[model samples]
Target chain A: MKFLKLSMSATAFAAAMAASTSAMAEEYKMVILQSLTGGAAFIGKNVADGAAMAADELNANGFFGEGNSLVYEVADDATDRTQTLSLITRLAADEDVLIVMGPTSGSVALAGANVANEREFPVITTTNSMEVIENGPWSFILTQPADVTIPYIADFTAQTLGAKNCAIIGVKDNEAYVALQRKYEDLIQAQGVNLASVDGVALADSDFSALATKIATSEQDCVFIGTPAAQGANLVIQLRQAGLDPSIPILGHNAFASPTFIEKGGAAVENVYLMGAWVPGGYDDFSSAFSTNFEAKTGIPADEWHAVGYSGMQVIANAIKDAVAAGAVTREGVRDALGTQTDIPVVMGEGTYSYDEHRVPHFGMKVLQVKDGAFAVVGE
Target chain B: MLSQQILNGLVTGSVYALFSLGFTLIFGVQKLLNFAHGATFMAGAFIAYYCTISGLPFLLAIGFSMVATGVIAILVDLIAFRSLRKRGNAEFPALVSSIGVDLILVSIAQQVSKTQVLNFPFGTFPVKFYTFMGLRISLLQLVILATVAVLVALLIFYLKKTTFGRQVRAVATNERAAALLGVNAQSVYLQTFFIAGALAGLAGVLIGLLFNSMQFLMGEPYMLRAFVVVVIGGLGSVPGAIVASLMLGVMQSLTVAYLPSGLTDAIIFALLFVVLLIRPNGLFGDANAVAGGTRQ
Candidate 1:
């Protein structure tokens, strides 16, 4: 009887050891493909912060599949298109990565999207451009489309704020701004607003004194600046300095939502209108929670890019959970699950999501005003 | 529209002149294009930003930035150009080395600063406006114009009146002859680089203050504009560079105002093409200047 008891004890110990080994073997890995170096690094670092935070949350909450925990791998593309393609290709081929997340710029996102489609790996893009979502059902945009945001600015300036005469200043030959200019011009004219002037400034333009002078002389009640935060803020400050203030409302597109805009524009930024997908200080509980947690984790206030990155990871994480629940780890299963998602809570400044047939989640936008150097959501 | 265009041209032209003066000096003395010159300008702007943000006085920040950039220029020559010169490498090889240095410096600057645009403190200077004949000009423009004028006059006086200036001219004309005539060509080259770099550094600070934002890649546009001015004004000619810079700036401003902004650069390039056709040696090239004359 003693010998039999001892044998049973040994067998039980072996069984426990096997269970531990199997659990360790089932650890799931994910790759964050992004540009973490070079000029885009500041924005990319924030994106990385959001992605990492989501990964940590999932791991801590045991939100992964029944047999799987999560591990993250980061690949820096350095904002190079060719490097991004190569990196995505290698990451997709890695049998360990259950999913892949970024490649921040719109152009890089488009490239990664093509590779993800072939490999059947899911990619969630944080970029605002629509071209990344045009071709594939596997791809998702965490940010609202520029088309949606740009027109919203136009409508806000025209019908809502009642600015009849508007001048548009955009970056010359920039694909994103050029696309936005077309949409904005069409939308503004449809609202019966007189498009006083559409001025194109070169991307390398350093001085706005000339543009400001022209705007001061023109019969416009508002000016819409479609450029990055740096150029936009510079234009605003110069316009104000040139004595064109209190005469026209300076409305900015999504670019103005960046913290750099506030830091650069300072006091001049007050009363400037900006259209964005999410505003941090608002009633959105999910965004509030995410912002607080993000700041705690990264030790940096969350920016728009961070919010988008977090949302991208959330979308992927949700789809991963749904896929595992359905006992389908294949790419087709993940794609189907992501496509059918409805009202999934996004951690972005914009809450909730609804995906169309293309599996692209549509998160609408809101307009925010810069008051006392912070963003406040104006009434819709 | 015409007045606005001209005003734009003048502001842009002033910046161009600032950039080309450095380029002309380096080209005149060293007989090297110094592709890394743009990186020097970019670095200077970033250093200026760092200083201003760190609570250094604005004027002190400008001076420190220039001095720091001058040191970097000396280092560039010592590490990259001096070695090539010592080895007696072909001019093409030296040019290629400069390009390599350019890449390294640009990469380092971008890595350190990232891509964010940093703004100088507002109200650092008064934003007064002056009107002449119904054309409004900002205090910033007047400052830039005055600064460039003083710098150009100083450069001219230095070249014509100072012993070091004569040594630079002698080395530029013939390094071997200057070396034989008790002039240290290497030292002359070093001084030229220092002066040129300091000028670029000053331009960077001026541009950052005037534009209200500075980026790591800001130097590329100025570099291109300076190149165009140098080609049009006649290479190695300081006075010629100033004239060409102002002309190009006015041309760009006028084009942006009168024509669509998209066509402004195209118009400028077209004008360059016309100038090249009319005078292949450039507008201010000497009588003995040869077409496609190689820098010695």
Candidate 2:
């Protein structure tokens, strides 16, 4: 009889503990859609990592208070546009999921934004297109747009580098790359640099021998290659091999500011001017602390993509926090809060974030260079 | 500058020739398209990349990659083509099967690579230049030129001088007749596929090292180019493929240099269309290819 009574008491105690734990808080999740397995995987993986880390940071700091915590549910679209649409629809149909953070690829992000607008779901994207903003107010972009950053890069290339004549080369098929090259062309020309060759190559162009032959024989003071890291590095190496003087500066877009660039280019990337925004010890105290804590937590080094992703999440979570405080944490409530939230402190650029009157996220910019085989801040 | 561009085109066309040789060979022997040729090409690069990173010597890595891709090509034929060939009306079904096989190989590589672009290690091939007669040429470029030249010569010699080559030609002429004459048609088909795959494999390695970028989808672009090369070179002619490849390469390079951007493909396809309209059998192809022929 005594043994039976002890067993009954233990069962009741276990049940009570379960109930207490379950009643402690409500968990809210926003989908962290990304291209974890494709051409953009480098960006997607880092972005997802930073966003998830931001969620963990919020929960640890008691920013969500005692009643709720955010969950950044991660998903991969494999860098496919069609898969991105399906993911957005499925995530939006979840009544509990109030927002979607990314489909990091520019083209895939644009497709997801269209669906998000039709579904009236709020989305924060990392794509570099102004077209996504045209999709509607329901979709928001958090990346430092090229229009704002490329001018600084172009000016730096022309003024600081003393490049009197500039040549441009990039992928003609990609709209973002074409826009970047055009912006550089216009701004560099505005700085009194005569244009030499505004050459465009195919997206799948691996053989730079033909293009490099043209550039090496051309009379340009410097050349701005607007391809991504590996391609850009290979081009630089080939151009050098093709007899372009090593003293001639190679200016590139922000995509060149990556560890992969350093790894792939090695000695070739030395002194190549690149556009970038984040580095652990390169930014403000907030960023420094965040980077330190971030490194301590995740064991992965912080990068530009990590900063963009963390800032993007803070923008989303701050709105969610406000909704929670107002006792109306619904999808529309979060969307309304996101529209009003501004000037939130972040770990990007000059250490703050906000959507401008045009509904585009704003951040500071910088120019980086490969100094002694490592990334170093050169200009802004 | 024009000469340099032509030189660049020749190097590129050499790889194009390497890529297209096998594609045309399969068509010559089997009269079926192997859409998975690109996948095998990609597989070659991936295999070479992995082998190199694992501390294999560069030449050894190239050899291993070629052999592995050859086996992969044979497997493709066995799985995707053999049954279709048995069914007698294999053209449509074989095309679909090859596509399915290509997708499977691509998907597997994607999963293995996790979609990261790969590169050969620095100094895998020495980075040295040779300047002569106001022209700058890298040692690697010379190596590529020499390698392609030797391989093409050897292939020609083998085709003209070997007994297996005779069987291959007979099979290409008429499979049933070759089989009735004890030519071992299956063996010929396998041998042709093996040779084609090995060539594509080497092309993949050279491109991966040349471009310093290798990814799962690297072969897709070449597949489209292969169609252009084969159709323009004449469906079943090796020498024609080489000439057409170099022509296409030089034309593409010059267009990129002189004309507006994005017209490279248009010019190339236009040339192909003109070739088709005028010389239906290709520049080097015999009239028998267009007239009622074997295999079809």
Q: Could you say which candidate leads in TM-score?
A: 2
lDDT of 1 by residue, A14-86 (tens): 9999898776645556787776764455456567767778777877787774446668887787767788888
Q: List-wise, what DockQ does each model earn?
A: 0.42, 0.59
For candidate 2, write residues B263-289 as lDDT tens digits. Answer: 788899999999999988788787545
Q: Fnat of the models, one by one?
A: 0.49, 0.69
lDDT digits (tens) for residues A172-258 of candidate 2:
866567777888888888889988888787556677787788888888889899986767888887887788878788988877765
Model 1, residue B32: what's the lDDT? 71
On residues B1-296, what C-alpha lDDT tens digit does candidate 1 reach at each position? 57866876777688778777888788766667888888888878888889987999888988999999888888878877887787774467777877787778877776666455676777777878887887777788888888888888888889878888888777777778878999998888778888888988888888888888787778877887788887788777777788899999887766655566578667777877887889875688653321122235
Residue A294's lDDT within candidate 2 is 68
What tier of docking accuracy does candidate 1 attain? acceptable
